[model samples]
Target chain A: DAGITQSPRHKVTETGTPVTLRCHQTENHRYMYWYRQDPGHGLRLIHYSYGVKDTDKGEVSDGYSVSRSKTEDFLLTLESATSSQTSVYFCATSTGITLQETQYFGPGTRLLVL
Target chain B: ELKVEQNPLFLSMQEGKNYTIYCNYSTTSDRLYWYRQDPGKSLESLFVLLSNGAVKQEGRLMASLDTKARLSTLHITAAVHDLSATYFCAVDSWETSGSRLTFGEGTQLTVNP
Candidate 1:
């Protein structure tokens, strides 16, 4: 209940197509993160933005890209969709001054690549 | 590299049963977090342990962290059907301050009547 919402709750796209998922938050949190959830692998970070226009790659950032132009919106794009990219994508926001805090997540987006 | 491992990937228990889930990490970290996710829903923050020996409890759930052992545990008392969900444990990354969170494979719990 952190006032976070993800657009396109579900999507199905073909390989080689470009797809973008949006995350919007009303809490104005300074930290926003994108993650993918898969079986056996759990949730893996794709990218994170510490502030507006500031972003960094995470452990699994190969096929994904992220951009944050405002404090309330973060976007994740898949340049070319692949079968391996089919998974549940989640967006999270955190409010912490020094990084030791719990993150609240959005409802998540389910993407299928065919 | 930071590695987090959770045991009992799947758990099934009765409403009044008690259970515990374990989480182990390969590297050192001061902070640990527990999250709960229902089917097709987003993760909900359950607990945050900031240091060694940190313990927190809410309702029927309790979480503890031991930095020296590089481990954390989530204990459930008198489980209920509503508590059925997947539980995930994450640790703070050592590379940066709150930069990344390394999560475990998650434990799926099913509470029966």
Candidate 2:
């Protein structure tokens, strides 16, 4: 554990409602990422932040948006939740160093959108 | 697009048996990581292989990489019930340095008595 935590460990919400998941890290790492794990999909990247206030879209970023205003906090928001977005979300952190900056994962948040 | 594939999605072996899990990926990448996940938990890294022919061992588990063949293997010796979990192999993206990794399908191993 690299001092990472995700809020709403388990959540169930109805569709068409907005939702936000929070990832907080105490390691002061330079990079943060949001990923979703599904039964057949393994883990798919949704978004990542390289530094404070800097973020980039990943392979599966269509329905998700993210914000990083501070070094220790990253937020993933879904404007309107959908059934397809029901999955386990994980937050990960890295130091941004080449080769050695291996990504460490958080405990993960289990979200279900009906 | 880089593709990562792992064979034998499910394995059931008796304790004390030896088995290996194979990971194959497309494209060229310099690093690969092996991680283990128990049911209802996050992934925990087990090995980080940097180059072809790189081999690392811990306890009854060993991992090796073959960059030329775009393959990596995780060998388990004297399997134990404690080793029962889902193993995943991830290849780092070539587009960025330690930016992200493409994960394999994962192999679920069960060690039975």
Best by DockQ: 1
What does candidate 2's lDDT look like per residue over B1-113, in tens digits?
Answer: 88899988999999999999999999998899999999999999999999889999999999999999999999999999999999999998844523778899899999998
* CA-lDDT, candidates in order: 0.93, 0.92
Instruction: Give the C-alpha miss distance for residue B65 in model 1, angstroms.
Output: 0.5
Q: Can you write out model 1's per-residue Cα lDDT over B1-113, one digit (the tens) per residue? A: 89999999999999999999999999989989999999988999999899899999999999999999999999999999999999999998744534589999999999999
- Candidate 2, residues A17-104, lDDT tens digits: the string is 9999999999999989999999877888899998998888888999899999999999999999999999999999988766755789
The candidates' interface RMSDs, in order, read 1.8, 1.8
Ten residues in a row with the worst lDDT in model 1 chain B? B91-100
- Model 1 shows how many backbone clashes? 0
- Report residue A93 deviation for candidate 2 (angstroms): 0.5
Question: Candidate 2 deviates by what RMSD?
Answer: 1.1
Instruction: Report the C-alpha lDDT of model 1 over A59-78, residue by residue, as the tens digit.
Output: 99998999999999999999
Scored against the true structure, residue A88 in model 2 reaches a CA lDDT of 97
Candidate 1 overall lDDT versus native: 0.93
